[model samples]
Target: MKATQKGRSPRGILAFVVAMLLLSGSLRLGSIGIAVASSTTDVDPKLGNVEAVSECVTDAETHELMELLKARSEQISALEAEQEKRQIELANAEATILENLSRVEEAETRLSQTIQRVDGASSKDVNKLTSVYESMKPKDAALLFEQMSPDFAAGFLAQMSPSAAAGILSGLTSEKAYTVSVVLAGRNANAPKQ
Candidate 1:
């Protein structure tokens, strides 16, 4: 009976220790599961923070693009304004040039009219002088012509009647008459026959 009691006591103690070890292992597994669930929930919030950062970066880029567009628009407007001002200046210069041309044309017309009037008055005076010389006596006319240039004496003789011109030539010195005759003959040398 003592030997059997000792054997039963050893077996009972071993069984009790195994049961305790199993309970401790189950508690550890439950704690590990709870920690895994809490970590998964925490990871979702971190992912949301990353998404928010991405959106902020996108907004910053959009703002920068809008500012660049605004600057470009302002530059275009300034260029258009400068072009308009240049066009206006060119139009004014054209108007001024046209006005100056009109004034120059008017001055030229007045100058042409003055020249025609002077030419008519000079022609009338020359005719009157020729008639006066022709009415003089042949001796007096020849004396006057002797002192004049050959060309000037020939001009008066051409305007007189043939008889008066012959009388004046007869009274002149032979040298003066010959010189006057030469000038009158050569006057039409350059004229076209046709």
Candidate 2:
């Protein structure tokens, strides 16, 4: 009997573990009580009661609910912040796009005006010079030939009548006409041909 007691000394620890597992499993308190009463009459004073179990379950559930609510609140706040940032970025991008489009429109208008001004001035200058060349006699025209390019004379001469050209040609000295011819050969007589 003494050897049996010494060898089986760990029986108390096994019983404690088995009791805990039984309580935590499908075994009800009534079954545990019956089993314990039949096995050992000595009841442990440290064992918790039914009220403690109810309170523990309630507290654990309450803590879990609080944690869930806290996580939800934090998630909502983060989402709201992200949404606000995106909205601001969208507004800024839209404003920048509108501003760039406005600038492009303004630049286009200015470029169009500049082109019109250049074309108008060019047309006016061509008309004015042609009129001046036609009004002067050939001899007087020859005198001004040095003032303008020979190509200008040749183009103007081509547009005038043969009789009128002869008068102008007769009045001009041969040396001047020869110089004009040489200058005309080197340049396009119909420059700005358009």
Best candidate, TM-score: 1
TM-score on alpha carbons, each prediction:
0.52, 0.39
lDDT tens per residue, model 1, 1-194: 56457776666777878989999999999999988555544334655632212222357778999889999999999999999999999999999999999999999999889888888887777777777777889898889889999998898888778888888898899999999999989999999999
lDDT of 2 at 183: 65
Native-structure RMSD, model 2: 14.0
Candidate 1, superposed: residue stretches over 4 Å from native = 1-90
Clashes of each: 0, 1
lDDT (Cα, tens digit) per residue for candidate 2, span 18-88: 98998777567778888855554444467743222222235778899988999999999999999999999
C-alpha positional error of residue 173 in candidate 1 after TM-score superposition, expressed in Å: 2.4
lDDT of each: 0.83, 0.72
Question: What global local distance difference test value does model 2 have?
Answer: 0.72
As a whole number from 0 to 100, the lDDT of residue 105 in candidate 1 is 94
Best by lDDT: 1
- Compared with the true structure, the alpha-carbon lDDT of candidate 1 equals 0.83
Candidate 1 clash pair list: none
